[model samples]
Every structure is written in C-alpha cells, then in structure tokens.
Target: MTRIRREVLTLPAAELGPDNPLPALRPLDEVHRIDGRERTDLPADMARQLGHEPLRSLLPARVRDGYGRTRAPRALDALVIENDRLRATVLPGLGGRIVSLVHLPTGRELLYRNPVFQPADFALNGAWYSGGIEWNIGATGHTTLSCEPLHAARVPAPDGGEMLRLWEWERLRDLPFQVDLWLPEGSGFLYAGVRIRNPHERPAPVYWWSNIAVPEDRRVLVPAEEAWHFGYERRLSRVPVPSYDGIDRTYPLNSRYAADYFYEVPDGRRRWIAALDADGHGLVQTSTDVLRGRKLFVWGSGPGGRRWQQWLTAPGTGGYCEIQAGLARTQLEHVPLPAQSEVSWLEAYGPLDTPSTGEWTDVVGAAEQRLAAALPRARVDEAYAAWKPYADTEPGTALAAGSGWGALEVLRTGLELPGTPFPESTLGAAQEPWRQLLRTGVLPEPRPGRPPGPTPVSPPWRDLLETAPATAHTEYHLGVAQWHAGDRAQAVRSWERALRRAPEPWPPLRCLAVADQEAGHHERAAERYADAFRDLCRDGHDDDGTRTAAVAALGRETLEALLRVRRTAQARSVWERLPAAVRLRGRFRLLLAELLLAEGRRAEARAVFDAGFEVADLREGAEDVGRLWNRLTDEPLPARYDFRMRPDTG
Candidate 1:
C-alpha cells in the first residue's frame, strides 16, 4: 500500500503583508449573478480593469473578495508522499502548495524549497508567496486563494499508488476547481489532473496556469525560438527568446531586468520543457496537449536587480525563476467557458537526466523515456491538417512567425469570441483583404473615444445604474449617455460616483476632468486629474496599461488647462504621473518648463525648454507653449515655420 504522511508546520506572517491597507469596505456596487443576465465579456475597457478594484466591494458578498491579511504565526499542515523514484511535499496550509520535489535516486531536491513561509503583495487577490509550484486557475495572476488554506484530501489509490487532492471553491466567481496528484507504481513521473467546473447557466470567464519555481542555476532548456509580450498596454510584440538580452535567456540572467513574457510553441508535438545543471540532474515538466503558451519570469541575478530579487525571495533563500505554462495561450487574453461546462488538463512532472549539450532532440528523446503522456503521437499530424485551412490567412502566417495569441484562431474561423481586447489605435478594423495579411487584424475596435456605447437597450442606463451602482463600468457608460443627453450635471455626478466606487476608475475620472476643462474650469479639472493620477500610484497594482491609457486620454487637456490658468504647482503634480512616452513630447515639455519656473525650478525648466524641441521646427504645437512661455517670462516662442500641413495629413 502507498504511504502518504502529513506534517504540521507553524510560521510567521510575511514581514510585508498584502499591500492593500484597507480592511474596511466602502459602499461599492455588488453585481450579483442575475439569473437570466449572465454577464460574460465586460467590453474591452472593463476587461482591462484589474487589481484592487475587484477586491473590495461595498455590497455584501464573499468576505474573501475583500482584500485582507493572511493569518500568520499559525499552525499549518503539509502532506508528503514518496516512492523509490521520488518524493513530493505539499503545504495544505498554503493552498496545498508543492514546496519540495526530490529525486530519490540522486537524493537532490529539484524544486527551490523556500527556507521559511513568506508571502507578498504580488497576487490579484493581493497576497502570494514565492517558491513551489503554484496551481493557478481562473484568470491570470496568482490564484485568488493561493495564500489561504485549501481543502485537502487523500485519495486511496487502489492501483498500487497514492493520490492527493487539493480543491477550492473560488470566491465571488463561484467557480469550483480541483487538482489531483498521483504517483503510479512503475512510473518514474508524478501525474496531475486539474478540472475547473462551471455549473452556472451562463458562460463564465476561465483561465489556467501552472507556475513552477526552479533553481536559478542558469541551465534550462525551453524549446522556443521566439516569444511575445503584451505588457501593460496589451500591445502584442514578439522578440527573440533565450537571446532577448543578447544572451540565451535559457541561462541565468544578470543585471536589473524584470519582465513577463509569453512564448508560443509552433511545433505542437513538443510540449515538454526541462531544466538541468551541469551534472545532468534536474526537473522536467510536460503536458498531454501542445502547451500553446509558456511564461517566463526572471529577475536578473545581479546587484542591480537585487531589490526585486529580494522582494520575491525570502531571506537566506537564493533567487528562483518561474517556469509557467498556460492553457491554449497567454492568460492576457483569457477565454470564457460555455454555460454549465467544465475543462480538464493533465501534466506530467519528474526527474530529467538531460545531456550537457542541451540539444532539443536530445531533450525530446529523454522525455519519451521518462515521461508518460495520455495523448498519442498521431495527434500532432492531425493538428497540422486542421490548421491547413488557415494557411493563407493573415492570422495563420503571423502565428507561424510567433506574433499572435489564441484569438488568431478565432479570427481565422470568423467567430465573434468574447474576452479578446478590442483593437487599439494601431489596430483599427483592418481593411478586409489587407487585414487578411496578419494576426493583429482581428482586434475588435473600442468605441472611438467615449460616448455611452449607443445607450444599453434591454437593461437601459437607468436599470444598470440604479441596480448596480457599485459597478464602475455601468456608471461610466451612464455618465457618457447623460452627457450626450444634455444632462451635464448628471454626467458629472455619475462619473464622480464611479471614482468613489473604485479609487482609480480612470475612464470616468478622465471624462469628468474633460468636462471641467471644456467648461473653462481649468483649476477644477487639474485638481481632479491630479487626484486620479495619484490614486493610480496608490491603488493601481499591475495596471501599467490602465495608467498609460488614463494619462493619454486626459494628460494633454489637464496640463493645458492648468498652464492656461497658471496653476503651475497643480500642473506639476499631475505632470509627474504622465507616462514617459507622453511626457517627452515637445509641447508637454514646454508646459513643464513654465510650470517648473512657477515652482522656482528655473534651472531645470530652462534646460527642459532649451533642449526640448527647436521652436523653429515646432510650428504644429508651438502656439500653446509659445503663449505659456510669453506669459511666464515675457519671451517670444522659438523660431518655427508652418509652410504646410502636418506630416501625417500630407
């Protein structure tokens, strides 16, 4: 019979608990799952909303939905199971986190087991820990309950093996997911099967990821040539993997670089990845189907990156890297499960004796011997044949070059799928035949600049706003509709209400500020814009794209209004939060200099204006800055001519 042991552990709370300091809930909207109104895709803009906004709700719901501190210095239990081939340790106290994996034959721990329990403010739920394999379900980021305890059970294996099960009933979303891990007799690898169940009648959002932490020994083999990153803006761009920084990233990285990247595997048959030291000993992770996308998180192993390295690792424990595999594609573009549906996946992990050469073929051969897969080799050929129909389509070709996400397949089939972010300025509805030229062609376009999106028909603006006042998105649309409907006062109230519901609800705040700016209330507009930007810094976590979008939407108008009224100090406060990309513009730089002078930062302002842009060549945007310059110092604007229209128009 298989022998599985459980151990209890006591530990201190993370020195830095969740970054969320608020334990008190405000009166925010609680959008209950209306029986017939199963909300799926929340529009592109709402889909982009994340971080602390979803954590705290004003209405009563699941307590866990409100971000809080993890109980510390408490009793915890860990489960241990081993065979002649290997041993595994799971901390049920920490969401059944697999803290250690050891190869019995070599007697070496393959996983980077953290010396002590340490959590951080690194998850969507606001608390996460480093080390071990984190079974991530639902949308991307850490699982909601990763830092919380999970329900654990021992499945008595009748087949000469031991199985351990860890499961969770997710908060708010009401999704239930379970993972079963087993080590069958005569098998050298550990097997795990995960099932995420959606019992609701309406389709629900779903995302899955397996994040495994490995020793930072600088020797790993991921058979990928290219990888893409959507980053904060969700702009898809690809770069060479392994050699991203001129060095094969397969090895340990140096310096202060920190990034999140997604690698798309073209050869569907190759679904396994391995990491080994010079001594031919390490760990291997493989899956049944093609792991469409893999994510690599690396914090440079040097003095420069030490700050972040320390942030992620506990004291005395060496730095570790995450080798994550996502279902179908990167979690940036999550998909929704059909109503009353469920999905299951399998992963095989075990010891690897990779050759020192690190050749792809050699790794594959090793996996074939030590790995047990549920799928047959014939599946690879079948996938190729199915993909043939998209051979001539733009998405297919772009995918071949490793430049797109899972949505490209939807584009190829002409299906209107939810969850994919709408097209940005760079991706307007591509003109048909020409659009057929790439994977980026199918991004749905956002409602150009804001205007209530045709005023909800069935639910109507009043229904959603009155029924779900805590919903930032609902209020945002209503504000726009109210403005267009000539109820400017109501629009202002609606937007302000949205801001209070969620600290940064940038869209509504930007719209409100715009209204004030247009009304010639420059001072009031500057104050609101500045406050919104400040909230972005305080409560906006992992929201680079949101911050960028907010500033881009209102920075110019806000700063212009402030400068026009000589609210230099207020202008400077807002200016600092603008993204580097937008602040570097000549017109913005000129406004910044005038403001700097107002604050008595004359030297800095003079340098900024002097070196910013030649006034002679600034004919297009010279007027605003020129006027500000004259008002501030009684000086004429730089010499510039406008003999013709702008370059873009020409």
Candidate 2:
C-alpha cells in the first residue's frame, strides 16, 4: 500500500472534563501481592547513596496537597496526529511526550494512556511518568527537558506525508537534539527520525535512549534466552531473564516479582523485539541495527517492589513494563561526536494482531514479517559482531558452525550466529545457574549438572573459578552457592572477597545488605544500601539504573526491616532525608502522615493525606486517611474534590 496523507489536529487547549475516567487498568491483584501486609517502618540509613532522586532539590514537594498532574488538561498547544490505521496525541507543553497512541480501527489504546500529566520522581532529570513512549535525549538517563515544554510543529515528510517535529535543549552540555515523527497514511507504524547534534565547537558527548511503556499482562519476546547478558553498576554478564527463584519468566509479568535486566538480543534474522498482548495484539519496536542495547523492567505484580516505585514515580493508573532501546551499550558509555558533528537514526513502532499469541514461532514470526517490511533483516555475522567487543570471538577464527532461533539454539538458529568463549572457563554447562543469579540478583537452585555427592555445586563453576579466580563475579557466585547450600558464614566471606575485587560491587554488596537486614542488622543494612549506591556511582554504571535498585531496596526492603524493629525515630529520619519524590510516595506518605498523627502533628498529617486524593492509584489511601483524621479531630472529614471522566458516547 502506498503512503496516504496524514492529519494533524491542533487543540489550543485540551480539556479533561468530568465525564472522563482513566481506561480500565490492569487489576493490582494481577501483579501486586495481596497476601502480605505493607511494611510500616524503615531505618534512617537505608540504601543511602543508592537511590533515585531529582537532579536538583527544586522538585515540587511530592506531598503537595490537592496536587494535580503537571500534564493535566489545560490551555496549551495540543496536537493530535492521525491516520486511517493509527492515532496519537502529543503534549507539546509537557515535553512533547506522545501521551497516547490508539489503534483507530479497533478503538483500542495501544499505549498506556495516563489520564493525568503527573510527573513523579523517577528520571534523573526529575519528574517522570509511567505511560506513553518517551524520547530520552541529551545526557544519559532521563533528560532534563522531559518535564518541560518543547518546540513542536507540524511539518511535511519527504514521502509526501505529514510529520510532527519536537525539539528541545536548554544548552544542556551544548547538546541539542531534534526528532521528526511520522505515521504513514494507512499504516500501523509510527516512525521517528532523530538527530542529536553537538552544537559546540569542541568534541562533545552524544546519547539517546528511546523508552516505550507497554501493558504488562502479555508476553515479551526477545531474541536470546540463556545467552541474554545482564549488567548492573556498569559490570555486565550474560544471563537468563524474567526468571529467578525457579520462576519461569515467560509467565505473565504481574505474576512475577520485581526484576530488571539490561540484556542483549542475539538473534541475527529478525533484528527486532515485540510484546504480544493476551489477545494476540502486539507492539513491535525496532531501531537502526547500531543501537545495541535493549532493556526490560517489570515492577513484579508482587508486593515489595511495587511499594517502593509507587513511593517514587507513583506508577499511577496501574503498573506497566518498560521496553527501552538505547543508542549505546550503557548510558555512561556515550560516544564522542566530532566537533560540529551530528548522528541520526530511525526507530519504528508497529502493531500485530494474529490468531495465535501463545506460540513463539507464530507470534515472533508474525512480528518479524511485519517488522521486516520497514527494516532490514538481521544478519548473523553482523549480529555476532555486536558481541565481539565483550565476547572472546576472534576475527580470524570462525564461530562454531550451526545456528537456530533462541539462546540454547543460538548455535543452531538459521539466521546465523557466533560464540564468545570466556578464557578457558566451563561456562557452557553452568549457563542457566549463572543466568539466574544475574537476572534475579539471587542465586538459583544448584544444578545437578555435576556429580551429586558431598559437593552439590555445579562443576562448570569450578572450572570458571579455576581460570578466573581473581574475578569478582566468580567469587560472588561462589559465595551465593555456598550461602544457598546453608553455608552462610562462608558465603559472607566469599561476598566480602567479591566486593574487594569487583569493579562494580553493587550485587555483592546487595547480598550483604540483605543478609544484614534479615539478621536484624537494620542499621548496618541501611548503611550498606547507601554504600552500595555510592559504589554504583563510582563504578561508572548508568546512575539511573543504580537509583532504581537503591530506591527499591531502601524504600521497600530496608525500610521494612527497620520498621518491624520499631526504629520509629530512625525511620522518620530516613523519611526526612529521602528525596521529595520518595517521601511523598503514596504508601510512605500515608505512613508519614500516620506517624505525624501519632506524634500529635495533625495539621501536617492532614496535608499528607490530602495529596492522595489527587492521585487515582492512591485514592483509597485518601479515604482511610480522612477517616483517621476525623477520628483524631472529632469532626467530619473534608470533602474531596477530584476530576471525573465524562461518560463516553460509544
């Protein structure tokens, strides 16, 4: 089909009136653990240096009473870009985020439609939300401009189609960037052509990360499984994903506990990634072959991690998963553009609606076909080359002969691939167990891949350590296996050695922190969490990833450990020192307010509860707090005024 003319509707002021309600959210029980009670307290020093905080202290007090989303409907330049097959809206006033993408034919919203333009603390630049596809430009992590207005206008595509252009830069490191968006007429795909330029005279840094938020109830299919590599605090190791504690990752996301991974896609043929909704509707994302890194983040529908994120970004509406594609391997490893140079590439998002969603071949084959129409096929040798820098592949020597789809079948997959051997280590048999540790941050059940006798540890591990004895990762896992075998003291010693030798020591330190918290070493656990964050920063890993782990551990794990110990004063101190983003989180806000009431600070407590009324996810907390406030004051609760959706005519 030929390209058709596209339409761009401009709204001077968008209105979110009383009849509108957020789209039916995936139920919290789908992912959030309901069996366990929320933690009531935490210690003062929990996950100190490691955390997600605003770049500056000027973030709006997360506890503002009656706070409304910064992206709420108001009189600003509103843009609606549409075609026969797809429709999308861009809020220029709010950093030009796509806001919404709807499949017009089905009347189904493909993107997570956040009814409000709420900005909570998540991005490094301060203020981020959990919906719509976000364009992360400028310095690494979330750009400083995500929360601000951008220069947007409707332009013409070279193919005689219409384009929406968004550009923003506040002289951020002299890095100015521009993105041209196009929705082909009668096409299901949205294409973005981005240009990040070093506007200054001297050599300047360039970075770009494209993040898409998709529904989590379905399944995400990546190229590799066991071969999927992971990195934390800047150190990377190949690992299995979405699985740990014997849980298979292919199950529904919300059912799984919290897990995050920066993984590599090793498939050579498809050169794309996809997420298929339960009903077989799919969202496919692919970038220029050069954008090497891909990441998956899930706030396990389980209890612990969700509590921490809500405190930070307020994962409002419901929890969603992130599919992130970056221009480079990690945020810190930005390329230096030539003086006055500019780099540009294309990224596309399309849809899939096939009869079969459960079958990998059916789903991925469908997505690959649809994607191939707009992109080039992934080449096996080229794909292996991406891993060349990190792997042991030699240019002169050829990869082991054979290929197929998937990780274990990677060698047999037809698209063609290569192998990277690490020294003389026997990592081959121990792949699964090592992957488990990398993906879950916890060790996996010992694989009986070795002789079953006095020593149950896998034998490949022994070979790995033999050749890489000084390696921190090898030592860390040695500790994990020891700990898992009920050798806690020896495990602790192994981790200590791992920490000293590893360049990026967060994982080893994290193990220590968890052990301390579990052993009622609340105070020390808190200190370790903070120290781990510092170690992450010092290790040159992406600061944003470190912050995510820190916040989750400190807010959920460390805080609970402290509170269960009745360290009220210490918890309060932690609450105070927390970035405004964390302090005003729904759960923590409720805790802080309740603590204030218990401390006879009713006025401040009331304000804290009032903030919840403004957020849909936290609305339940608002009601309970109101009841408690009335009880303490011997008066009726104040009436809550919140916006409601006008009824739909469909």
Q: Which candidate is the best by lDDT?
A: 1
Among the numbered candidates, top TM-score falls to 1
Cα lDDT of model 1 by residue, 552-598, tens digit: 43565567667667787777777887768657655466667777877
Per candidate, the number of residue pairs that clash is 7, 25
- Evaluated against the true structure, the overall lDDT of model 1 is 0.54
TM-score of each: 0.53, 0.49
Cα lDDT tens digits for candidate 2, 1-650? 22222234332222221210110101111111111122112111211211212122111111111222433334444566677877777766566677677777888777766554455434443345557788876554565456555655445564455566665443334345556667755667777776665534577656667877777766776654542322221223445654544654544354334444555566353345666676767677776666666767665554433553344333354656777777654443355678766666667676766433445555556666655654444422332233223221222222111111023222211222121212212234424544444344444433221111111132333334334434566676566555544567876887899889766666677678867864778778767765654454342232323343244334544455455556666556556655566455455665676667666778887777556533323431123444456546755444342111111100
Query: Against the unseen true structure, what C-alpha lDDT does each candidate score?
Result: 0.54, 0.50
Q: How many pairs of residues collide in model 2?
A: 25
Error of 2 at 154 (Å): 2.8
